[model samples]
Target: MIFTLRPYQQEAVDATLSHFRRHRTPAVIVLPTGAGKSLVIAELARVARGRVLVLAHVKELVAQNHAKYCALGLEADIFAAGLKRKESQGKVVFGSVQSVARNLDAFQEEFSLLIVDECHRIGDDEDSQYQQILTHLSKVNPHLRLLGLTATPFRLGKGWIYQFHYHGMVRGNDNALFRDCIYELPLRYMIKHGYLTPPERLDMPVVQYDFSRLQAQSNGLFSEADLNRELKKQQRITPHIISQIMEFAQTRKGVMIFAATVEHAKEIVGLLPADDAALITGDTPGPERDALIDNFKAQRFRYLVNVSVLTTGFDAPHVDLIAILRPTESVSLYQQIVGRGLRLAPGKTDC
Candidate 1:
């Protein structure tokens, strides 16, 4: 690719490739959101001449990885279910684990190297489609060079980078799960870098986040046993929270709101200044989504309310404000939402 690689990014990619060549074993890359992990993968594919198979967890990610590889000059093909193939006749194929799992017997296994994006999602044992992919790959090619990439290496409920030394899938020095961290590159840093609109820091205000009704619907009590149930009916961002977000947005031009559900997102749109708000959800038709994106780029939408989407791939440089309305125990998810504001905009003024 013609793009320049940051020092840290190059080092991360170098470390991963070194591991792959060293032990002939799988290696993982831990990069925060907005750190251009996709670019790192592209760089790897550029140098490695073998037929590369990239396995992504979701449809959106599959599309993103495919486009990124193509941009990096890798001939790419996608075998994801229900998705049409583009013109990128790929030496590298990006496939959904589910799609390949369903059509395993009919597919070819000539790929010499395999890359797993978000490898932490590879479920336990050989039961899940992910684990099944690993098994199938081993059966098809014994000398496969495997590489995994994700922000968080430790699987949920698994111990930190320390306890996962022998966690079956994690590669590299178990202690080096983290590189020099890049957390300082959040919204505050972006504002300082002039990448976003100057933060119009007005007098601080008090805004309450009311979770009463949601708590009431979710058995009126918090419990690990009720998490999934609570997530289903609970409001991702409450009206009080929305008011605070609006206040914050008033200080910035473009704002990004992360909500829990479609219904919650609709409520957020209603609360934002009408005629200047856009909402994107999984059900948003493709054409409509493209239009919304265009309008957003045109700055017609001051606030973008989103539900469970836009955590990755979707990029808006004007996103000066980010509302983490969704409660998540995942550090990776939190970092992803926050990194939406990390792009360094030069010559920006601090408000």
Candidate 2:
């Protein structure tokens, strides 16, 4: 299969390569949800005719990248569990961050390039898996070049991707993970250009619980336990949200509900007709989760509810309504949750 690139995607590829050639340092590329980043990554691997490791946090993304590489007629091997064993001699390897983080030295040869998908997950903390793995890899090969791709390159408590130093303190806090953003394709621009569906956002007034007393985490977000406790106090909120979803989804084909907890998701499913809805969470068994996702994609159900899952790598293009029952302070999470409905499906004018 021949891979074709749109003008913007080509620009992204060129800009990333050009930045690498000029600076010889790590770089990041920001592209909207529906902008086809896999094609760009395929082209980069095709051009960089050396050992390249594509890293993603989730298994779905690892599999997705390998599929695109195969579609592009590129020889790539998967290094993640449930995919393939670690291929020491393969030039291109698609890897899950969790799977390969411990075995950086397993590869016989030094990788010339490291491409990180969903790279914004790299936290400011030095003890993070990403930082630890990259630090070890750098010790092995000092001249390695890195390319990071993400739609949102900023973290909640941590600053932007290319941020160098904080406002007041300049001596110690020089935390610029990626040197520069080589290219960016904004979601608004993609919507304007008809590449993505514009989100029709609606606000539902829910009873606000006083969470002011809840202890804030170091990341400036409330702890999950506290948030869940606060959310559980408002008994009317879940019913109201369920009613709103039922009302709005009456005219839509598929609705994705992001719940705060597994209990909340089960409650949502309890409200809907048993056969019309399903629930999935991180704790769900692998086979059950896959089946639920497949059934949802097959349109066997009108509503799919998930907690702390399906926000990043799950893709259901026909989802016309995204009901965010989980309130989040992270902008990346908010965008990712809404992005589920941003894919341009037939007759989907707005999400």
Candidate 3:
């Protein structure tokens, strides 16, 4: 191995191997953000017999995981369209779900083990890309062992990702993708052990938007339209929030602002220094988005205001301050957002 696995990370891999030895059912390994899940995935793939396939929701993660696996002096293929590479015939393949779902015939029963990074994105929808690929691949390879790694194990509306959690007895979901959480590394444990930066919540903002009147859908999240309407009713709320964020960011190295919407992100960017801040929404073009993210990591900018894009699969260890201007009732979503700043970096004390 090129890099030594941390104690908890090796434990996670051991738990996974043990689970597969005892049962054929799918299992999950819950590791918080910045806990080096990619390394664990690499080690697991390295040890697994037969071909392996690693799935990620976005191209960023597809590339990230592929790089980690390669760092072991091992060979693997990448099958993500966004990265403009699609080589499926290899001992190990890292692929984006969209590209793989569209071309399942190339992979047909070839893999013995499948690893999904950020598996919580696999929803209950049977027709979803992830489900479609899983159904097709499992049909061809009945002995295929499935493993998932995620920071947040629960979905916003759908409770848990697995039928059982090792942490404790939890509510069950028959439709959950994985059968059990074979292992988990707690956020508090990582913080106490100095593996991650501790998160400290700031005082309540002087101005707060009233979301009480908004009703949640069956999915347990307010509709985007409703959130925008409610936010509009709060007079000068965005301005006040941005002002407070700027005040707090003065002492931080890197600041990330989670905006409620695209327009909201733009407004926040407008309030920040034009040269020191950048906005990234789902609509940003691919090349421009990549450049913006690269610049932010290089410290060319101080504040990065994004809308629902940087929650997962983004790595910038220098980020120490995270301003959540968006309101969410989902614990999983909130945790994923805050986890962005919890990575350890030089000269960084806490998030």
Best by TM-score: 3
Task: Give stretches of model 2 more than 4 Å off.
Answer: 82-84, 164-173, 205-216
For model 3 the TM-score comes to 0.96
TM-score-better candidate, 1 vs 2:
2
Ranking by TM-score: 3, 2, 1
What RMSD does each model have against the real structure?
Answer: 5.9, 3.2, 1.5
lDDT of 1 by residue, 1-351 (tens): 577887766876677666666666455566655566778777777777677778887776788777887886556788887476532236677888788777777455466778887766665455888777767777878887777776666544444332223224433244432322211123444344443444443332554343344432221223423433454454443566677777666756667888755656777788877888989998998778778977886778788888767776666666777776555556656656766655544433332
TM-score of predicted structure 1 = 0.75
- Scored by lDDT, model 2 comes in at 0.80
Positional deviation of residue 346's Cα in model 2 after best superposition, in angstroms: 2.0
Could you tell which candidate, 2 or 3, scores higher by lDDT?
3
Best by lDDT: 3
lDDT against the true structure, per candidate, is 0.64, 0.80, 0.89
